[model samples]
Target: MVHLRNRKNNYSGILIAISLVIMITVVSLVFKQIFLNRNNENEQNSVLYIQLLNKAMPVINGINYNDEVDTEENISIKGQLLKLIGIDIRNPFSVIGKEISMFTIGTEDSSENNKVVKRTLFKINPFDVNDKQINKSGQDTGDTENLELPNRNVKVNDPKLKEKLDNSKPQVLIYHTHTTESYSPYANYNTSHKKNVCSVGDSLAYNLETEYGISTIHDTTLHNAIFINSYHRSRVTVNKYLKKYKDFKLIIDIHRDGMPSGNVSALKERTTMKMNGENVAKMMFVLPKKNPHLSKNLAVSKKLEKISNKLFPGFCRGIDLHFNFGSVYFNQDLSNNALLIEVGSQYNSVKEADNTGKYLARIIAEYLHSKK
Candidate 1:
């Protein structure tokens, strides 16, 4: 009887071990598929994989997972996973593959490379300011004559407009959808507000208030911490502001452009332009084609582009219509005045971007002052 009981217990133990092995094998296969399949159409899968790994790592390593205390351990697990998948997190290109690259090669903006479909109304030769004028098809016209810009002093004669401007109410709301996008002399992304798009937003807000007398609000919320559904997170922030403040005239989502991995040199050449004998980062206006307020937004962008070309030629890279076939609204439907502005590419220096912020503030001020 004793021998039979021991045999039964041994069979039960063996079955339990086999079950555990099968479960682990299934989990490993899932992880491998999630990480190796680069063409996965579901963008949220990566985030889900990370979250699952974060929870699973503790159990696999036999460590207690306390959410607050296991932060470093979670990061260590992520690093290990990256290594297991033959990915070097330090390489910007490798990181770009894991996350979406802004305006990168083979991305939605791939049309920028094909001159036939390039939507740039005018492409300014940064090397020669006088060579401004590229037609709709992206050909240089080489027109040396400068285009006359609207007068900056052309203000509306409405007393109500003047009062609104003078009331110290915020007229512009500047936020960053990809808040961690950094510039040249650093990696592609950073958490430091001083080194990222937040710095540009700061410069813009400061210039708007002190130099142009335009009250501005700069929201430095970190929305891209997870790198997925970032627009959704930022949309909540935008809605909070819209509900709280009624005076915001312009909603600007600022971002730094990104090029394909190993193409920093071309990015620099494309995004850097000479202005006032100094290198200033070029700016681009990106509009979602499906926005409900497309006409009003396009009008605002056109006005800004004209003002930029007149005052600071070549600083504005012509407006880009994006996501025409998709559902990326970019929160522009909430307000007709919403604008997504890419200040510069990842290779531009912080100073160059700051220079752009100052000029952008001036352009915006001119627009607000001229509006009825």
Candidate 2:
């Protein structure tokens, strides 16, 4: 009887020990799964933060984030949770949250961020008369000019080619393809003619008529409703004017440039520049390589670039001959003197762009008065 009782006690102790081991193993697995899930959530949150940052960077200028300063404490998981809950301690009126409802965080349209692959045929040196050849790989074949302005006087030696200026008729037609392409302080698709690129066109037309004594037609047509076919819509507008008027010497399509996603450094460099003791947006002349009237259009671009740089050094970012991408003609095939001008980037203010418009009017007036 004593041996049987001792055997039962031993079996009971063994069973208790086996049950403890099984409980411990199950607990460990639960903890491991919880830890893994947390890690995955953290990774997804980080990715979401980056995407949000990219969208916000262009709208909010002069905000820089140092990678080294992004410690776990500075950008904690708790902080991310706070952001998700609509509280950003860093910025009181942060665009990240729903509190600032005026600005849309996402792109207005998919075409706004569409990737355009292009090849440069040539890049004109505004300061130099010589044309620089760009390889098919879009690299300069010759020594590139230093963009820094040097202390030198540039005089416009007008060409002997002459055309009669008809004061009774409009000589220039200025329009916007991406009409809603707006600027800083309020960056987004805005329909108000007072706020968007239409305002710049208005300024240009006013300056051309009032200051330069040049007849101009500024078309305030909105064509970016379907952004993918913006050029096509603007082309119809241009054709209407062409059919009505026979005296149109120059056809200009004005647009604001956009910086690549998350490239704030480029935004600073490309958009704004100082001209005549005031800050103004820089201008770039875009010429289509595939246009039927390439030579005439190229001539117009080169002439304007030269004139602009001569007047305001470093104001013109130089002529870019784009090939095999974007609007192949940019409506330049419709007219020899047609040009697609990018006045400023999305970061430039309407005031800055208007300043550029005033200067652009002067440039165009000079170009028009000169002998071809």
Candidate 3:
């Protein structure tokens, strides 16, 4: 009986030790979580947070196109939230996690001015081996010095396009997937890497209508609350939105690039144009291969690139072909008139890029008028 009782007591002691260990673990986890929420909140307001808010940066720390997060609109909301909570957001891990959850939880602006985001939808870009490159510029991109090309007038709009009944009224679709959600009034610029596109596109549309006697319609297919968005996908959506207007022949998708920027020199550049006292925006045509729909006829894109070269000299960037069409066919397949233009690299000022749009608008208008 004494031996049996001793064994029973030992077993009870073991149970107590196990329970104590488990309780300590739970307490440690909870305590750590509390410190994280408290100290990290201040971290949210720092550069790391500003980075998360940057629209121009597509991937950070190699995290991109997360299914749970709508990177398009995560910035301003995160910024505002962090600001309110006194969070500095200095930690990369915290910034990445917060951005990932922003889309997962579907945070959006609830306002009438921000209606565009509510109207548009986004496709999720999966993480694919094909998507990542240890080096994005790739090998033998060669001295960008090879950028010069001869200019020509290879009509860029749809061959079916005609002079509008009112040539003075030039219209356009000013859009961004991230732009759908409005954290505040547009008085504050929206966070989007495509800002160069936005600024250039707007300037062109305005000039076409105001200076040239064109009817201008600035429309957005996706309501302002759009969380997840891509340029190619948004371009396709814009074409469908303008289908009712048969005269809408020119479909241009404006974009900004991530290349390092400085002076542009070309072996073939011979002409220059100025807008608002700044050199006008320069352009390159983008073509897509592998499409069920019509490919961005390489012939058509190359022809326009050459024409831009001829007129403006060093203005034309080389023709670009990419398979990363993203989720958007870019509706270039919709008409031979469609174009995907990269206005400037991300580092450029919106003012410097403005001239490209104005110059292109003139080219396009002349091309349309000359058709007859």
Top TM-score hit: 1
Can you give the lDDT of residue 40 in candidate 1?
23
Write the residue-wise lDDT of candidate 3 on 43-156 in tens digits.
222323334535447654443342213221233434454534434353344344345543211122233441212222222324333324566654433233233343333333
The alpha-carbon lDDT assigned to residue 160 of candidate 1 equals: 33
104-177 in candidate 1: lDDT tens per residue? 22212234442213121222222432224633563423221122222233221223322323535678899998
Give per-candidate clash totals: 0, 2, 52
TM-score against truth, every candidate: 0.60, 0.56, 0.46
lDDT of 2 by residue, 1-372 (tens): 999999999999999999999879654543343344442233233333443455557665434333212321255433555544556566544433354333333222121222223221222222422124432573432221222323333332233322344566888999998777776655455677876788889988887777666678899888865344567778899999898885377988888776543334334445666655556778888876667788988888898889886787777887777443346377888898898888877666778788877778778878877843
Task: After superposing candidate 1 on the true structure, give the runs of residues whose Cα lies further than 4 Å from its correct spot.
Answer: 1-168, 325-328
Predictions in order: lDDT: 0.67, 0.65, 0.46
Arrange candidates, best lDDT first.
1, 2, 3
Give the backbone clash total of model 1.
0
Worst 10 residues of 2 by lDDT: 106-115
Order by TM-score, highest first: 1, 2, 3
